[model samples]
Target: MTPQWLTSIQTPLASAFYKRCGSKEKAKADERVAVIRDNSQQIVASLRLRRIGGHWLLRALLVDPQRRQQGIALQLLQFVGAQNPEPIWCFPYPHLQSLYHQADYQLVAEAPEPILTAYNVYLNRQPLLLMCCNR
Candidate 1:
């Protein structure tokens, strides 16, 4: 789902992300999709999606670090989950498992293959668990 707010902010975010990643190669990649929550004031949280397995995949989910445990993350997940209409898969930080599980997602034993990326390397190349939610 192409979010209107994300569509508005995408160019700048892509520019910043390309600079941080140091690569135009991945910046222009069509697979990346950004979803945001805003109330005509500020963005609450944002989730990124990438296509895999002929279905939409949840690639990144970030809540404002300052706004933890206020249901912001789950709200973002729920909103994005509703828009996509396909099973959503996630690779959440291990500590966030219980929280996501409570949101009707099931933890899985292995990471999905198509999502292996440099971000995983930064996360120590550990087996990032998978979780899926169908709504």
Candidate 2:
């Protein structure tokens, strides 16, 4: 069964979710956040979309540790595609290629600048996959 669709989340809550992922980065003012919340209204998973180089790049996909392996990440990626008409860029880890692939994201040889530069930096340190979902 498909998971419940995401709704726009406020900035503070978005930052909280990122913190839950052990990242110090907070949601930017220009970035839009989408989230899946539990019955108690606590965010279970979320991702940020920022317009970079005239494209929406997906970032900071975080799922509650207790909620992993439930396809929440795939559902969130699908939800982003359904909500946007433009192509969305994502730099998922190599291991998550299948998950992003199932969400309609295809492997891309190159991504836009700045983000690509960032991707290269991360790739230098660890394996990463650059994919984009065209809607």
Candidate 3:
């Protein structure tokens, strides 16, 4: 479903969206549509399907801090995976590697330039696992 603010490029949604993903930096929100789940008047979870260069990237997946361990993220990942059978790429934290593996994403030694470049700039110099789902 589309959020009304998402249609406007300069809306507060961009900042709010990245904040939801725990990011302080801005993103190109106009590049793709996001899937979100709301509870009452609050947004609980969200995931975006982004096109970077020629590839589809699963980006900015986040679940509210209060909603962790409830399988929401898994469901969202599955939904995104089912929607596109083509390969999708992501750079997930090392701890989430196994979870993405269960969703059919396998770690890759090499990634596309955009992904690789982004990985290098990821916060805290945190090690990220580059994975791809080749469904």
Candidate 4:
């Protein structure tokens, strides 16, 4: 039931976890990873909070396929939100708006510089929702 939020996600478990989510990038110093694992040490949920231009970007929120429908993602969201009062930006799918809303995140019309650039790129590819949790 214990989870970890660390600056490095280079561990074998983390690598495999991200791979399962279809993203396999090298861990950067500016990124922090949060992981919650099952009793067997298998990752059940995970997300990364990356500091971009002084803003925290939330991404890669992956919950195990078998573990969906549970509150694992919400739990992780709450954990991160509590860890710091800074605003966290996330670009999730439209369907996930309610999920992020439950974590006290509100829809935002615009984003800051670097993130706005990336957001536009994502918007072009798919329908997404941009939200921010300002604490």
Question: Which number leads on lDDT?
Answer: 4
C-alpha local distance difference test of each model: 0.56, 0.77, 0.64, 0.78
| lDDT of candidate 3 at residue 8, scale 0 to 100 | 34
- Name model 3 segments beyond 4 Å from true: 1-22, 25-29, 39-41, 120-124
Question: Which tens-of-lDDT digit does each residue in 1-135 have in candidate 3?
Answer: 223223436334544756866866344645454445464545566656667677787776777787778777776677777767777888787788777877778877777788666656663366555556544
Quality of model 3 by C-alpha lDDT: 0.64
Residues 1-135 of candidate 1: C-alpha lDDT, one tens digit per residue: 123234533635644543443434232246454534445534445556667656566655665565567887776666666667767666667788877787667865454465444235535765665455443
Per-residue CA lDDT of model 2 for 50-129, tens digit only, reads: 88768788888888888899888888888878988888877888788888889888877776686687667767876655
Cα RMSDs of all predictions?
A: 5.4, 3.0, 3.9, 2.2
Q: Candidate 2, after superposition: displacement of residue 43 in Å?
A: 0.5
Runs off by more than 4 Å, candidate 2: 1-9, 112-115, 124-127
TM-score of 1: 0.63
Q: What would the TM-scores of all predictions be?
A: 0.63, 0.82, 0.71, 0.85
Ten residues in sequence with the least summed lDDT for candidate 1: 19-28
Candidate 3, residue 80: the lDDT equals 70
In model 2, state the lDDT of residue 129: 56
Q: Once model 3 is optimally superposed onto the true structure by TM-score, how far is the C-alpha of residue 128 displaced, in angstroms?
A: 4.2
lDDT of 3 at 85: 71
